[model samples]
Target: MIDGLSFSLLTPPLIAFTVTLILTGWLIKNNVLKVLDHPNPRSLHTRAVRRTGGLGMMLGVAISWASIPAALPISVSLGVALLVLVSFADDIFGLPVLGRLLMHGAVAIWFSVALLSEARGWMVATIITISVVWMINLYNFMDGSDGLAGGMTLIGFTCYGLTALLAGNESFAVINFCIAAAAAAFLIFNFYPARIFMGDAGAIPLGFLAASLGMIGWTKGLWPPWLPVLVFSPFIADASVTLAKRCLSGEKFWQAHRAHYYQRMVRSGLGHRNTALLGYILMVSAGVSAMWAAHEDIAVQLGVGIVWGGIYLSMMIVSERYLERCPGD
Candidate 1:
């Protein structure tokens, strides 16, 4: 049985959720920071919303993670802190892209080496490093809409926690669940017509965890890399396909635009709430399926992959046709 889930362990994330909720409310009420994210062509929300709500989630994670007496590496904690620090500063001061990217690259390299410690070959190191960095960017790219990123985190990490439990890795399970709980709390204020956004501070660190923790579990033999990819497939498929299409069309991939499948669905008249809810449904389905299929044999895993592939392909085909039919809607 997945015995790592006890009331004591659950308490931390519960406390985190409560604190995050209260803290987010306080920020919204006080308008804590004067800085706001104004609407541009790419924005889903039309009004200026305070994006500092990421602070609450950060606080929740910090307090709860501190409560855990586990002996995780100090360097890992330091790297995560640095990422949040840089992202938070950028959220407030709008730091230059080059500097932010440099910081991201530095942290990515450190963790890439740590995660790939078992196989120090240059090719392995280089590939995983690029993958982790891409995860960070892809996550940020997918966070434009309300509740989208938060919901994905909840589902994705919870799936990770479940897989950890199955692997008898109680410590990893608790950590993943804690992150999920905090994200759930953030979702309270971040849902459709959000009063506050998570901004870079929340998004960046979360993206880092998604890749790092996923790799950690893989290294430990808790789950295969494909499992995490399937766990976060909704996001992976959307962001990767969009990025590829943009590159193929010679578009400036670094620039922001309302081009993601989720964004396009919203712009095509689905609205934020519907699009977000549908995305959540897909997340839950994919996560649950991955969680169940992780224990199966390689043949079973391959079969699962093929089925999901068809499903995603069907979605792409149907969505494209539906949008075309409603081009002026």
Candidate 2:
């Protein structure tokens, strides 16, 4: 038996994993929500798959978060609930993109204002609010491939939890660990030939939490703001760069396309499994470095960011060159 195992740490993740596994299995068996994701021009998957995995994953996270109420703020919890409801509606009824973005912006602004209060100016709040919205949409943008989003969630939150634990913030650590564990459970069916997709219901709220929790931790002094950005940079870099490229080419940047670096890798013969595995390697490396640098001085943290920026740049250049040589339809 493992000695010194605290129930506080063990119980929440256990609940998260068990709930996600069982619910996901049930969703697969029943197709209860019946939100089928079909192949599209931008889709990576070839056939229709049930996208109800988000219901199971978010349900598990909600249950676990409820169990550890002290770890999260009431406002953030409410924001997540709002995102889930609106996002699930979008999945079912296909809500207008503008309307959905409005809702996203509203919640982000509210959260940012509450988070900053009188401590910061409107300019700072505006930037963070925009960032929160970007994170929400960017995560949705990056969820096209198998195992990519789930793997990022697992690694990113684990890094966040570990950083909080190192800083002696047990409640915050448990909150993040539960999310990571739930994502791990989601990955059981999401890897490679995926059985289900998280859909908007799952991805939007998770993106919100990723930004919200990271900002919360920064405000609370548990970790630097750069740490969260670094940990989630895999998704960030790919989505932002792709968006930029599309805009530069005078393309409809908001419309879906296989322009993302990872999507290109998949189309360029990397396949889903290898692309996901390689992505896992990048995610783990980024998260580990972020965690380590969180405890270092300002100079070291800045250096870490610069180094990772260079690495991401190199990877993108290599991927673009490889794709130019093998341009897949």
lDDT of 1 by residue, 179-247 (tens): 899899999999988888988988888888888788878888999878888998999998998888889
Worst 10 residues of 2 by lDDT: 320-329
Clashing pairs in 2: none
Model 1 lDDT vs. the true structure? 0.84
Model 2 has a clash total of 0
Put down candidate 2 lDDT per residue, 1-329, tens digits, no spaces.
Answer: 64444777888888999999999989888845778998987688899998888888888988987777484666688999999999999989999989999999999988988988632788878888999999999999999899999999999999999999999998899999999999999999999899999999999999999999999998889988788899999999999988888888788887777778888888888899999999999999999998888878999999999999999999988888888854422
TM-score of each: 0.94, 0.96
Model 1: per-residue Cα lDDT at residue 323 = 78
List residue ranges in candidate 2 displaced over 4 A.
1-5, 69-71, 325-329
Evaluate all candidate structures by whole-model CA lDDT and list the values in order.
Answer: 0.84, 0.89
Candidate maximizing lDDT: 2
RMSD of each: 2.5, 1.7
